[model samples]
Target chain A: MQQPIAILDSGVGGLTVAKEVMRQLPREKIIYFGDTARTPYGPRPAQEVIRFTQEIVDYLLKFSPKMIVIACNTATAFALETIRSRVSIPVIGVVHPGARAAINRTQSGYIGVIGTEGTVNSGAYEQALKQLSPHVDVVSVACPRFVPLVERGNFRSEETYNTVNESLAGLRSTRIDTLILGCTHYPFLAETISDVMGGQIALISSAEETARDISTILHDKGKLARGDLLPVHQFCCSGDPQMFKMIAQQWLNEQIELTPIVWQVPHIG
Target chain B: MQQPIAILDSGVGGLTVAKEVMRQLPREKIIYFGDTARTPYGPRPAQEVIRFTQEIVDYLLKFSPKMIVIACNTATAFALETIRSRVSIPVIGVVHPGARAAINRTQSGYIGVIGTEGTVNSGAYEQALKQLSPHVDVVSVACPRFVPLVERGNFRSEETYNTVNESLAGLRSTRIDTLILGCTHYPFLAETISDVMGGQIALISSAEETARDISTILHDKGKLARGDLLPVHQFCCSGDPQMFKMIAQQWLNEQIELTPIVWQVPHIG
Candidate 1:
């Protein structure tokens, strides 16, 4: 009777997927966990990110969510398969959404992706794009600092503007009609990324497509939570309560209570 | 000679403080944890948050760092006292640093505090401000939604912009020149908040102040870590790693090697 969908991310970024899911599916309650303690899985080695991603999936499984959405590009790249293999529930990631959006929006047949080193290095978006449209060429840049700048609340800072411009400078050499904000954090700099890249370049967030995927999956699998007028959202953070709450409100535009959960690493293999 | 400082937040929000600390203490290395799985400690009851914060503190203490900075408002409000009184090491919260900043910048003779419900309800910021300036008047708003918006990277959305405006609409009647971002996530909405309230209001972020506090505490207590320029960062999440990496790199602007750590909750009582 209680088939909550668990949406987990390193931080608030996952809310994008959660919000979309909320809009797309009114009956499903969501249990969201943002590993705010150790976020930014991008630059880390692949093994480490995979292991870290597993812990969240395992923890959220306690709620016995019917499905799990990675809601992050890095997780999709490194951990989706492992998560799917370890758990019985359906697992999803953001890479497919980004790819789908890129394929749908590109008029010039050229797309660009800007994300953290890990995401760019993993070639997740490129691979996804190739699968969707083999003829389309993708330009990828490792936006190493965009996430930090957005988290620091400096997306509009002159320095942030310059940093984003610097990171995106490569795309200027080629025309890209559709630009995927490959990383969730990149949406914060959407205005900046758009202003620099121009209005013509469509700034697509994978959130909408991710939400659509959840709907289709639920409909096809008969896993949608049944009978809940207002779905409940439970937020968990591993770090401090204050920062997590502040960010949640700013991101979700809803005032929901977040209960802190102690996550002790009793065993790390 | 591993003297890496320990920094923990629910997610990358604490990295703002960590970034400043790195600039201040270039020679020192740091160990950071963002409980990205479960974040936003504001709306929850005090006891739960305290327990959660304590677990991370206890976990990080295993490294035996000289000091620990709970660069989060909710943790400071709920458990900073207990942690400071009981822990062997010097424990600091971001609240005091921002409070000090508010005291210094408040020219209108009136101050406004905005943070998670826990922080405002706990009266931590108000009390901290009063401790510095007993006569000052402080208006506190428990902005529970700000964090989600920032985490979702919706700082520029119509909903987020509207929310910021709604939160600050009443604040203008108070004539407060200085506003403390009371929560780390509020800073992410700086543009919207600043635009809503106008730049005439100086937003005080505790990131730098908290760094200074940690530095002072470590210097005064002689608990600063010794040796090694390894400067490597270890991150852990209670959630998925893919989303974590995206936000981490964008918000923290640093490369980290994240490792898998199991999350266990033995007993809540």
Candidate 2:
């Protein structure tokens, strides 16, 4: 059996990425890890996020993944470059692909980005966008409540709608024709967010682009799983395996056994 | 010195992909080969095309490219998977990325594809689109005159306009909202083609997408050129180096040396 593509995230938000991966690359198996015990990596310092990401990657390397996807926007913002340097296998992150998609989709050259505070504040999307399109304007805002609402699975509530509307109110005045749902969790609330932004605005989700990037890299590297063998997929989390399992089953419509991960937290001085 | 990204095409058509690669990844040093001696590999037998592509790829391997880009649609249609398996470095092709971009841009699920006979007949775009979005309808047309016009540098004449309009006449009735310029040579005819298809239709060129894929692969492989040193880009042709040099200088607005390749034509039994 081929080594599964490994994915890690702060929590269930990355299940958005995982879902797309399963949909797009059905022949390939996945091994996912969610740091649910340390959910909301948005509020953490960059250094801590890097350390946590490194720990998760170290654990994933043991499984011998053909590639690793940093599915967390916050962790990707802080740790992608570092983890890529440390790993031999291909490592992918959501931010650059998201920015590239947004750059491609935007007509007015006015692009808006919304993510966790860590992702927005980190200016990763802005840097990526500028790198792709030098003159385009990048407007980023932090939807601080969106991830929490998704984590609690309160995506369709009126409360979620109101929070989305209130959080995105500042963008209505700007001529931003393309909005990047920069956080993986935000696509779960795509309907409410789309309603707030109106039909003219294009919403760029990194999940699909990231999945496509994975396929390109795999095909290029000759790492694509060959033959029609029944493949096995794994799901694990550092905290609350049951919650992750429930979400995985619901999203994937398959019963998956999830193992709880308990890595020794290294003391970071 | 960083290993150059190697790009091969049947003729100057792949110059389009090379131009975009130079634009998008300025730090990248590119080694390009145009098989001008066998300019139109379109309509040729698949095995012959593959043999010709392998010959060119064998020539490129001497440069130690960090990656190989099959910049010609016909070559990619005929030989990408074969070359990929034979090489250890990343081998990228234009068709898949072009298909991906078309899938992303087509809102009506009705996509039009225009390419050389080999590319159109290969049904590579249709397969790629169906793999990504199983329901989308793909309409492909072969424009035999277009490549010769580009080769002859006849991009803006009234005859060229009439040729593009007549060539794409069949697509006007298909209600296809997105068009994939499947051949790398087609983008040079973008203005005339866009005018023929009208302003509403989105044209997808594999050049920029292929370039992005290169950048993504390089970054993932940890082989992206590190220093800010001025990169030396090489251009070579199996046919007329002088004509290729003139076009290259005009298109890129930079003086460049064109090397004429003389490979012992392998005896095909």
Candidates in order, TM-scores: namely 0.49, 0.78
Q: For each candidate, what is the lDDT?
A: 0.74, 0.84
- What are the interface RMSDs of all the models? 24.4, 3.6
Grade the docking of candidate 1.
Answer: incorrect
Which pairs, if any, clash in model 2?
A: none
* Tens-place lDDT digits, model 1, residues B1-269: 56567888766677677776665454566778777667767787999888888888888887787778887898888888888878876677888777755665566768888988888999998876654444578998888888877666566899998888887788988878888887766666778888988788888877765665564445324455444343676666666677767776766676766776535422311
Off by over 4 Å in 1: A263-269, B1-269
lDDT by residue for model 1 over A197-225, one digit each (tens)? 98888888877667656654553344555
Return the TM-score for candidate 2, rounded to 2 decimals. 0.78
Worst 10 residues of 2 chain B by lDDT: B260-269
Give the lDDT of residue B223 in candidate 1. Answer: 53
lDDT of 2 by residue, B1-269 (tens): 58899999988888888888766666678999888878888889999999999998888898998889999999999899899889988898999888777765667889999999999999998877775555588999999899999888888899999999999999999989999999999998999999999999999999878887887777666676655665888888877767777777777789987753444434311
TM-score of chain B of each: 0.91, 0.96
